[model samples]
Target: MTQQKIRWLVVLMSLALIGLVIFQVVGVRETLNAKEDQFDGSVTEALDAVAHKLEKTEVAVLTSRRLAAERRKEKLQQIAIHDRPAKTEPKGRKASPRKADPATIQRYASHSPIVQQWEFYGRVTVPSDVLNRTNGTLTDAEMHYVEEYYRNESPPLNPDNRLRSELEKTYDETMFRNLRKDVESVKARRDSVGKFLANRVVGDRKAAPVRKHMPKEAAAKPKVTFSRPRVSRIDSARLPHRHMTEFEKAEQKSRVMREVLLDMFTNDRPLNQRVDMAILDSLLKNEMSIRGISIPFEYGLRSDDNPHDFIFTSSPGYREDRLLDGYSMQLFPSDLMATDNMLYVYFPERQSYLAQQVWTTLVSSVILILVMASCFYVAMSTIVRQKKLSDMKNDFINNMTHEFKTPVSTISLATQMLSDEAVAASPSMLNRYLGIIRDENQRLGSQVEKVLQAARFDRGEVRMMRDQVDLHELIETVVHSLSPQVEARNGVMHTNLGAKQSIVTGDEVHLTNLIFNLLDNAIKYSGEVTDVSVSTASSADGVRVTISDKGIGMTKENLRHIFEQFYRVPTGNVHDVKGFGLGLSYVKKIVEEHKGTIRVDSAPGKGSTFEVWLPF
Candidate 1:
């Protein structure tokens, strides 16, 4: 694609990504708001429930007290009756209680706690015994009811027949449970008093398991009859009241009592006294948990006029953060807008809780945005790099064409002159033309080799030699070869071999070429009198070879791409410096392959210095 097209594409893609990020952020914000709204609704519901629970609790307490007082009054009346003196009967007759009729006795027996329970439970066996007790007022046939009552009473083995109707059953079940609890309490007390060992011994002697052996004939015989196993008896009363038997009427009365309890349960005190901080805090925790909202909270009851004046506060934290806005509602809001107290509930981590509610969505959105951004970045970077490489390649082609064209033209011209009759007639002229051809051929071959060597290095095809190489000797050899070129240019070359250790492992040919390229660049880009300095010195775990030139140096910008392949410094309309711009680049590769480093120091108008450090 063209540069303009690539730039527009990048711009458009960037805008799209930004828009996508904005939409995702908005979506996450909306989700958080929704979660917060739900949380608020739940909190309000829980608070209302807590208020109702408090009211119900108060009603139950008052009702229990009222019931206890009535029971005490009944007990007082019973005590007075038992302590009262017997009435004077006929001024001299022995005082005697009136005997109750059979009908009255039966009526008393219907209540759960029957009249004279001990004597009633011990019903008289014979008529004479009842006659003696009643002062001969009852006859034998008339006392049939007493005998019939004993006969009709269900035994311990069969209680279902005696406790007829649901009401009686319900009361009987309750009494049975209480009796079991009382027995357990007695056993617990006996064990607590260190009577466990004594009880265990007495129990073993009194209730030891005994197995009676039966005769073989008896065991083989068929069963004659079936008898129910004996069962423990439960204390029960037969309620004769019609209201107790009529369930619907009884339920209606219970409802009326509940309404009275509810009215008494409501708190009527002033808001300040009504809201106990300790009780409110406990209620808040419990109700919030019931609603499944478990988070740290702060609550305070401030005045309606001045919010700063707190009637009650759950904690010091709530007081400190009172200025921060939270959920505010009226305490005792049951009175509508005229509520006296203003209650405020704050969540220190409200924002964090909202985030947690939508954590999965938030994290996924972030990851997707990052992934898209990274992909766009990689795509734009690749385009830029490819464009840069394309420009460099074009520059390289032009430089190569010019470099090759010069040598070929010279060789052609010399061959044409030698072919002429006058030029071939003299030996000097013939030799001159032949020399020109040979020199041009060598020049052309050298340029082709430079290109080929770079290509081989690019493909990693260049073979390496592991033998130790002497840097001092290698620098001298390269200098000797390039000395002729320096002399021709009216330049001077200096070598300062100062390193104690100069041997390194590398390819001999490539090392020679590496040195040749640096020296060549030093000579090519120089003033009228080229002054090149080649030196070797010992460095950290290596030998550093330095090549410097007192010539036109480069700018900082050019220095960046100085070692880049096919990259030449821009000099408008001037192709003064010639080559494929491959020398420095090739030098860098060779140095790196041998476990070495190369750095260059250069600036505009100042001299340049190339430092190559190869480990010994």
Candidate 2:
């Protein structure tokens, strides 16, 4: 009982040790997982904060650039249209004063249609009476000057440029009847210069300057004039809300709201609890209403943080999350402040909870298996020990039977001789008693040899001195030894040994005994006039030795048990064959000691075939 209690204590201590190890492992894993979760949350918060800040900064920069560009355009317009030529100079002035340099005048003319028209009208001469009455000038030269300017250089006084004024201005329409031709020439020259610049100066490596010839006086002080369009203040670009459609507006709003919600999920711990479809919809509507933008949208939080599930913008564009350093990201709206509504998208949170759960389950299962394996190993060891004890008891019984049977048989024979007085008086009765003594002695010797063989095998003292034994020669010798028994049973032995000599590495005596055991089984199991066949062949796996007999064949189930100690087939026929059932078992043990396998294939009514395969 004390020993049993000690065993129980050992088992309990082992189980407790295993439990403690599992608990520590699990606790460490859980703590690591918690730390990882916290780290992930911190990373998400950092990323969301960064994305939100970037979105606002981007919106601000774009708005500043847009407003700045507009202001610069307004200043350029004011510079273009602040001055004018107040109804041509006084009559005594040098026709049109050369106030600026040629290039500056050309630039001034190129930028101002009024200046171009003034130069054209002032340079020409006309009939004094015809021009003076029309432009309110009195002298013939004044009238001539006005007529010359209108007739020779009236680029801006074309019919399409009908600058009607309340001052009631008039000109000889008949004198400018060919005005269309002049206008066409000016347009052709402008187009030529534009094409030349586009195809050569702007598009190629070399450009050829346009040149014109003039007289000595004109060449000494040459002037070129150009016609330029007027510039105006208060210029306008397309407004942000102008191009946006109702559908586009709604899409933009939804995109913005989605971005906001995603940001909340990443940064705010309580964001998930605050989420609902109605709240998102309301948020979008309220934001757009405040901006005086009409939009229709359905908004909700996407279950995941995939980019595809992010903002879906129909107007302006969408916002995308871009990964930055160490678990942070940047979100930037595509359309910027060029559009009426802007959206902000947040960073994504990686899925780690599912991985943690799987790891926990896997670890738990391993712990359970370890505990069960420990228990199974212990139980199997105890059962095997008990089985070994039972086998020793059976061996003792077999040994005792052999020890008593031989002497009793010899004594019985001697007593029978005494009982048969008539035979006892004769010499033949004495010979019978001597023969009985010899037979009993041989049986006793065999039993003693078996016990010694088993003891040697058990103690690992059966040494095998290996040599290259000729298999054909070995088998032939074994067959020669069994010839007498074969003849006694009147059994025909047919041998088909391979012509090629096969050599095996083994102790010659054991190999010979293995062959003899098979032959003995064949002779013992056979009925009268049995045909036993033995054959040997060489194969790649090893040499194969087959022995078969046409006898009372065993069932398939009995064939499997044949090699077990003390296991014998229950042959259905009533016969006088008895056996201790150790022959095949001994053969199997010897074959296995040489690293080989033995198999039997048989069924009821079909003869049994035994095959032994060994690898070289």
Candidate 3:
């Protein structure tokens, strides 16, 4: 391809590769981000789960304490009952119903308002809006009473007063319990009927007519039936901090009451006992494994108010500095006593773990990208080199055409001159034209042979005439033949035949051509006054031939491709030098056929040296 087309191709291919690389990079980046987000979500969920479990265990512990206390009291009561004596029964007589003792009734009536209300009206009726008037919080006096009741250090300040208050508390609790039961039954009825039969508001009553009403009989007692009452408003202060609404699913009031109960039972308990770090660790591990997170981790329970203050830790590494590095979750989130404790978990290898999720894809993509880059580079280089070779081949063909045309034209012109009768009569002129034709014919044959030899060697069709050749004698023969050209340029050819043995088994004809080509290149390319040297030395390899010239030497770039077919160094404005640019390539091939090697050394403005080594 031409340079322009090659350039466009390279640019287009480069853009494609760059775009693919960018696309891959972006995809990997997004994948990593997704993995990270998923990891964070899984970790947060696990942490919340562990915190929730800790809260459950704390609640269970508080409930167990209350049960143990009640059990102990019941066991003592059972022992007392067992020790007491049983009353004897009268034979064949059913026990009569026991009447209340008048003194016991008098004592209770003196202390309890419930007893007084029953005595006066013969029915205890609590106000409908009584619940709205009382806030759920206990007063200072009530709190002291509760504390004293639980401690039981001594007799209460007023035992009867306490007993009367307890009775009133029990009566209010029973009334509310019965009311809740009645409301539940009414809800079921409403669901079945889809609506209440009686309206929420009480209706006006009509006077009973004498015709429809029945006369009162002896010992007849009438009972009045009341409609369902309207729901009274509750005290806002007694309600949970967050109001319950239609949109709210969880019962905030119930959850708050549970927290309150838990705090009341466990407020005096040890703070560390509220959560077990060991159990918390187990819960975290199980949750994380469910999400495919199998890695070492550290966890800590730190105070929410002051994170530096740790309540407990699975490991010391989970500290204040690393608190931000981990997932944080509130422990016993609704527990009033354990509200300050927060859970924190950190993993040292979290980044590595996330990277490993796409490790196979990442590694494979990078390797493929490198291989593609390498292959692209090699292909581009091969294409460009082939283009250069095509250019060089064209140059060689043009040079050979000119070289052959000059010789053939001269030969044709000389023969034409010999055909002149007058020139033939002049012996000297006739002899000159004949010699000219003969020399031109020899030139044409030599050029044709050089081309044929190079082509045959390239096709591996040139068979070597294997024979022992003496390099010392071969060098001398080539030098003698080119001595006249060296003289014409006022140049000298030096020889150093220092080798004791210079015999090598090789094709005599090809070896002679190899030596002749090297010597001829030295003479032609050397400066006006050619300075050439030919030397052969005895070495471990049998023979070493060196041909060097103090000539217009080549640059490093030219020396690199000097042995490539159809490659020639640029010699500007010096048209006298001419060749098919295949001399060195043929020479190198000939040396290789004989199991030898050739090398050159040259730099700009410096002389050039060509070295040839052959084995015996």
The candidate that wins on lDDT is 3
| Candidate achieving higher TM-score, 2 or 3 | 3
C-alpha lDDT values of all predictions: 0.70, 0.54, 0.71
Model 1, residue 314: distance off in Å is: 3.3
Tell me each candidate's TM-score: 0.68, 0.43, 0.71
Best by TM-score: 3
- Residue pairs in steric clash, candidate 2? 110-228, 121-149, 124-148, 125-148
CA error at residue 191 for candidate 2, angstroms:
64
Ranking by TM-score: 3, 1, 2
lDDT by residue for model 3 over 258-321, one digit each (tens)? Answer: 4446354435554466667677777888999988899998777766555567777776544565
Q: Which stretches of model 1 miss by more than 4 angstroms?
A: 73-267, 270-283, 290-292, 301-312, 316-324, 329-343, 527-529
Q: Which 10-residue window in model 2 sums to the lowest lDDT?
A: 197-206
RMSD (Å) per prediction: 17.2, 22.0, 14.7
Candidate 3's C-alpha runs over 4 A off are 64-80, 83-96, 100-260, 263-271, 304-306, 317-320, 426-432
Tens-place lDDT per residue, model 2, 117-226, is: 33322221111121112223234555456557856875655453343321112221322332323432331122221222111111112222323222455335434343
Query: How many clashes show up per model?
Result: 1, 4, 1
